[model samples]
Target: MSGHIAQDWEPVVIRKKGVAAGQRRDEKAVNEARRSGGPIETIKKFNAGSNKAATSTPGINTKKLDDETEELAHERVPTDLKKNIIQARTEKKLTQAQLAQLINEKPQVIQEYESGKAIPNQQIISKLERALGAKLRNKK
Candidate 1:
């Protein structure tokens, strides 16, 4: 019947169970050993159905290159393409830097193409052809 009713309030504390102290110390030691690159014992579980070869090492490159792939690996811009680029650029009276600016490319790119050191790029070749009014690709 009172305007305000009084009630008892009780505070309760709850604690969560965590890893045991010995287990935590063992984990810390294992982490430290891994960070320091020290050898650690690896336990391999027995699996009867695992088809993986036990003697094979992981991440080893076992691939052998074929003749075609080997040739492609050493491929560069053709000498003819380099000569054409140089000739067209010179006939236009454009310096390497000036031609590069006209094609919106770097001067080093023009130099590389002229020196036959650049890898063939069709898009850049097309841009150069349009800018210099010449055909740079080989005819089949």
Candidate 2:
């Protein structure tokens, strides 16, 4: 043909490793890694001094209020409720161990109530009442 000779063309290669091996690569992988906390190796690779300076404000307080504590302080079992449980169990001829089994509670817990060592929550009191077929609360 003419005075110029034809040259064979080859595609340009931008990456030699990772997903885009032997082809063109972009910042997509790097951007994703930055947005999400990337692999462990990448996380450990960074030691940016600017990050510490950026955290100047103290973190928010996440502790919730103690509503249960306040409510229980006022909703205690009546002083004579334990006596009622003892009276009911005696009338039914059921031992503390048997009563505890009926209510799905430990025998020692029943003992604690009889001995006035533990003031159970409302749920336990309700369970005890159901198991003994008695009302342990004072009639008002």
Candidate 3:
């Protein structure tokens, strides 16, 4: 079966430029109209959904934000207090289901707690602290 493999020295013809078949459109008029436009005119429709990426991709770096985004953490509250719940659960080595079982609550309730949709009051907090052995409130 290996005898059919092409030789390594074979010349591979690569097309370096020009549009691909079934996907070419005229953009000269669009360029001319843009050249005559005034400044601050919103430039162009960068993302009208139907538009596909073409020759003009104006490169962008898409690395994930890796900074100490703690400054941006507050916004996650209510939508993110669930993080604290997850943390507490992990520290206790308990799954959401296990935690819910201990607390007489539904697994979805634990999810809601973690999602910041349901902030537990003193009673629930105490139950959680007992269940997970964590300090969840101010020490006053």
Q: Extract clashing residue pairs from model 2.
A: none
List the lowest-lDDT window of 10 residues for candidate 2: 60-69
| Worst 10-residue lDDT window, candidate 3 | 72-81
How well does model 2 score by local distance difference test? 0.75
Cand. 3 Cα-lDDT:
0.66
* Cα lDDT of model 1 by residue, 40-124, tens digit: 6545567657857764665444443222353436568999899999999999999999999998999999998999888888899
Which pairs of residues collide in candidate 1? none
Better of 1 and 2 by TM-score: 1
TM-score of each: 0.53, 0.44, 0.39
**Residue 67 local lDDT, model 3:** 38
lDDT of the candidates, in the order given: 0.83, 0.75, 0.66
Q: Runs in model 2 with CA error above 4 Å? A: 1-78
Query: In candidate 3, what are the lDDT values of residues 1-103, reduced to their tens digit?
Result: 7678766797879988986643334465445556867232224666677646653554432223443355543232243345656888998899989999999
**TM-score of candidate 3 relative to the true fold:** 0.39
RMSD, every candidate, angstroms: 11.7, 16.5, 17.4
